[model samples]
Target: MERRRSFPDVLAGVVFILIGGAFVAGSLGYELGTPLRMGPGAFPLLVGAVVAALGLAIVVKGLVAGEVIAFGPIPWRAVGVIVLALVFFGFTVRGLGFVPASLVTALLTTVASKRVRPLMAVAVAAGLTLAATLIFVVGLQLRLPLWGPWLGF
Candidate 1:
């Protein structure tokens, strides 16, 4: 026997549809004029349409399939770590510089991942931070400081 749609699933579908509709309506008011070509509204309008379609599909699928979607338990620890890391980034990025901020953020996020060991996670985070710095800062010629002025970089 097929399972029936639960209240939560129905609510989620309705919420998504409402949000998508709002985005579409908001995008319509954005001026669609530019000298070169398509204006700022074009991309948002496309995104809104896609969101609306996906929301509609979700609603239709839930109704037809009649299956209750079960979400797993929330990972509170991971959420906390991510939020803290973001705060740390915001506070430290300008003063401590990109490399350190990136490392700290990456390490926190990696540690939050369920599968990672502390040592391996640290190593991966360091590697990723270095790679990101090289790509986004050096290669892209972005003006981010490699190290703080106190460290004299």
Candidate 2:
């Protein structure tokens, strides 16, 4: 079988490599100590080198093996809905409280999926709220209100 270059992987590898380079560059501003007592720059620089290496590997693979990925259509609605849900969560978390904010966000994101029914969304939201409350509030003991000022709590 004839091998072809993988353009998508190459692109992703390049992006990762660039991001790693940025991390390394940014970390350079901070003082990096020795291996025994590593500084802020140490981690970032190491991550950057790893990213660059991975990118280089991908580029090499693309050059040697012919593997191409066809770009699929983007899911605009789902992306928009998830992003909107996060924005909503950010705005309402303090006011509405953790449970409500999580519920709303989970519900919105779930509903964004075409396969999810209204009842299913509510169920998922409720489950998410319960789990979040138990894990964050009861388990981890985060200093966040369950219900906010609106509920007179």
Candidate 3:
């Protein structure tokens, strides 16, 4: 019989606990009304408490009988591409219009993976653009124009 503590599990649990605790503390600044008339702080306070409790449970599990798992190598290229895509989307969304900006961003992110073909990337990007348009513009009824002034629309 062997008892081994998982470093990764413990670290993750600690991080979660810290984040939850911070949220809980921050929420205290706002008014937390009664259950019937819940204020702005109530939701964050409750969620933070739950997260902290979960983190504590994870820490306990890690200490008792944690399974050994190896951390995989970081995907630097994918990370870079995704970040770039997000930045591009943010910077160009207003000028390029929602459809064009989202399309380019989705395409960039889709092509970040080495296995994705050009055609597949474009298809995925188009689908994503359509879905985003439906969700943000149509469904939510956002005031953003489909085609911006930069596109002569």
Candidate 4:
């Protein structure tokens, strides 16, 4: 029996390696000071090395004993919706404030799946919004207003 290779793992590992390599190379341009007084390049250099090593390990694992996963067709609609949702959140967060912006963003993301019902999406969105508000505003004490100037608050 022929050994099977995991295509997704190999591809992901390659991507990680490329990204890590880029960071390592970019860091070389800056001054990497000693461990005691690290320069800007030091952190990136260390991080990049770790990333590249991890990527290499992933690639090796993929080639040696990889799990077989069915690569399905790309859901372009879901992808587009998610991208739009992220953009919407970034664009409206300041204007609409945290709660409303998060709610809308979460709703858009939840509805990205075609099988999700409207009521379910709304509920999920509300939950996500509340969680985000509590985590970011209440817990973290982020200075963003719950209601922005647009709401006359």
Candidate 5:
């Protein structure tokens, strides 16, 4: 018996490795400061090494897994909807404010899935919006307004 390749996993691993390599390469120009005072390259260098290691591990797993895997059909419609929702959120985040932007985007993305209920989407959107606002704005003090200038926040 012959083993077929797991194309998706293998491709993903390669992509990760490429991205990690790019990150490391870009960080090489900057000075790497000590842990007490991190330089421009320090964080990126650390993250890049970790990501590269993870990609290597993924590649190893994919190779060892016999390269034989069954893949489900890609959901193009769902993918399109999610991408559009992300674009919408990006455009509206400043104008509509974080909560509203998040809610609208969540609903827009949720509509892509046939199994999701309207009420459930609303509930999830609300919960996610609140959590995002609290975590990023209130707790982290990210300076992004819960409501933006358009809303007089």
Candidate 6:
């Protein structure tokens, strides 16, 4: 006898498949380039293929094993915290810069976890924000606003 598939697993598989297909289709318009040099489409194509494969595997496992996926109660507080943080990031990043925005986002996310201390969360958020700023701005040399014109960073 086959095991029942979980509803969550099935739903996840379907969602992944849909997302993967969208990615694949979206990447098709991008230039893939010659074998010597990878173009814009290369990474997206690879990601899309991997996502589709994972989705297919999940779906196949669900169907063949007959596993029954279940979900517990929704964590609304956590979701709200994350959404709020992201919204703040979207609004503040241009004005405040990456480090500050990241710090805020991290703090909010940590608090959302509901297990971390406030001080520790603040410290972690600061450290993560600094590190990320260094990596993305300094190391990668990607153009990002460090601060508004007033600060002149």
Per-prediction TM-score to the true structure, in the order listed: 0.56, 0.65, 0.61, 0.62, 0.52, 0.53
**Root-mean-square deviation (CA) per prediction:** 5.7, 4.1, 4.9, 4.5, 6.4, 6.6
Can you write out model 2's per-residue Cα lDDT over 1-153, one digit (the tens) per residue? 577777787887789888888888898899899999998888888888898888888878877783767968888889999999999999989998998899989999997788888998899899988998999999999998999887788
Evaluated against the true structure, the overall lDDT of model 3 is 0.91
lDDT of each: 0.83, 0.87, 0.91, 0.90, 0.84, 0.84
lDDT, candidate 4, 1-153, per-residue tens = 456688888888899899999999999999999989999999999999999999999898889876788888999989998999999989988998988889888999997898999899999999989998899899999999898778888
Clashes in model 2: which pairs? Answer: 3-66, 4-65, 4-66, 4-67, 5-66, 5-67
Worst 10 residues of 4 by lDDT: 1-10
Question: Judged by lDDT, which candidate is best?
Answer: 3
Look at candidate 4 and tell me the lDDT of residue 132: 88
In every candidate, how many clashes are there? 0, 6, 0, 0, 1, 12
As for TM-score, the candidate ahead, 5 or 6, is: 6
**Candidate 5 structure quality by residue, lDDT tens digits, 26-131:** 9999999988999999999989988988888878777666456677799988999999999999998988788889888988888899799989988888888888
Comparing 1 and 6 on lDDT, the stronger one: 6
lDDT of 6: 0.84
3 Cα displacement, candidate 2 (Å): 4.8
- TM-score of decoy 4: 0.62
Candidate 1, residues 1-153, lDDT tens digits: the string is 574666555667788888888988998898766657878787777888888788788777777664655776989989999999999999888888899999999999887888999899989999999899989998999898888765566
